[model samples]
Target: MALSLWRSVFGGSTNAPEDGGVAFWSSPERAGWLTKQGEYIKTWRRRWFVLKHGKLFWFKNSVVTRASIPRGVIPVASCLTVKGAEDTLNRAFAFEISTRAETMYFIADSEKEKEEWINSIGRSIVQQSRCLADAEVVDYGSSEKR
Candidate 1:
């Protein structure tokens, strides 16, 4: 039921691969190539990013399957802000996703791409937060009834 809704919205399968390769049915809300800053080295590396189910996942390449593990994953619900940081980074298409712990930087291919990524992440954060709130409400109501 939930998987069906996820597929309906993202247009991908949730099934694991039969051969233990990539899960071809895994559909993302948004996917593209972007350059991301390395956490320790402070260097930028090109990566393939997929946004789905209120999570942002990056891989070495776009050929994601069930066997392919993400290089990094960011839970959108934990994010505090998503905004362009071109001037601060001195990069043309740079943006930032900031959480309480740290701020991650990324550079898109163009201005439109940068804005689109920011918007997508912002929407995911809002959606995830709302889901959390809805769950809390349900729990509160159930406890009251009990």
Candidate 2:
């Protein structure tokens, strides 16, 4: 079957945990399967991705136990942008997430999935950035109490 073939080729038995199996405490904001471009080889490899606690993590398999180790991780706070990159990659459902140092590309299953990922990641970036900013603000009332 096509599904089995996809699994064999991609190394993912199922979609990544949609209900947050990766983290111990809270559910992940989003999780799914995406084909990501290799860092140096220019090859594409299917990865199970999870977005949680302002971080994006990818694994080789969908089964994420407490001992599971992510193949890679991108802190959402460090990301500057998440946007469609179909034109740049010449591939459908392609998008890019970039920080100051690098841009990583991923291909979703469909246009809808692509947009969903972009929105989720974009929101995470904004939310995480805001949290950092909030932490830096001086609290005059707290200072007065001391």
Candidate 3:
């Protein structure tokens, strides 16, 4: 009964890992607070960012409520890199995510937090690449093991 309620409310499978088994990130990788640029506009706003299922999600604030949906989401698999953007706008704790679609900029509270986000996102990209490589491998005819 409770499980069904959770699935119906969250719209995702209960058996799926809560954080999508992102082993590189922290146990609760939603600790980073960042300022994200609006998707379509030039305005920037503060948001609480979470990484899960090879994607990055942003909320209005740090406290995640069941009723509140994520304000924005970026697919980490499509992201090419996460690196420091100290040159951009002269912000020391700034980092950027370069995706196939667009580059997104964010400001972390400190240098340490900025590095953590970069490391986590970097790991996600590598993991996705490995998964894709494994899936692409095919034994044409000589499957000795099989």
Whichever of 1 and 2 has more lDDT, that candidate is 2
List model 2 lDDT by residue over 2-58, tens digit each.
233223323554443333333722477998999999876889999998888777877
* Over 4 Å off, model 1: 1-25, 138-146
List the candidate 2 regions with Cα displacement exceeding 4 Å: 1-26, 139-146
List model 1 lDDT by residue over 1-146, tens digit each: 22333343334544432222323328788899999998778989999998877777677898987677566667677789999999989989999999887888999999999999999999999999999988877544456553
Candidate achieving the largest lDDT: 2
Rank the candidate models, highest lDDT first. Answer: 2, 1, 3
Once fitted onto the true fold, the runs of candidate 3 whose alpha carbons sit more than 4 angstroms away are 1-27, 140-146
Worst 10-residue lDDT window, candidate 2? 1-10
Taking the candidates one at a time, how many backbone clashes does each contain?
5, 0, 0
TM-score of each: 0.78, 0.78, 0.73
lDDT of residue 93 for candidate 3: 89
Instruction: Give the worst 10-residue stretch by lDDT in candidate 1.
Output: 16-25
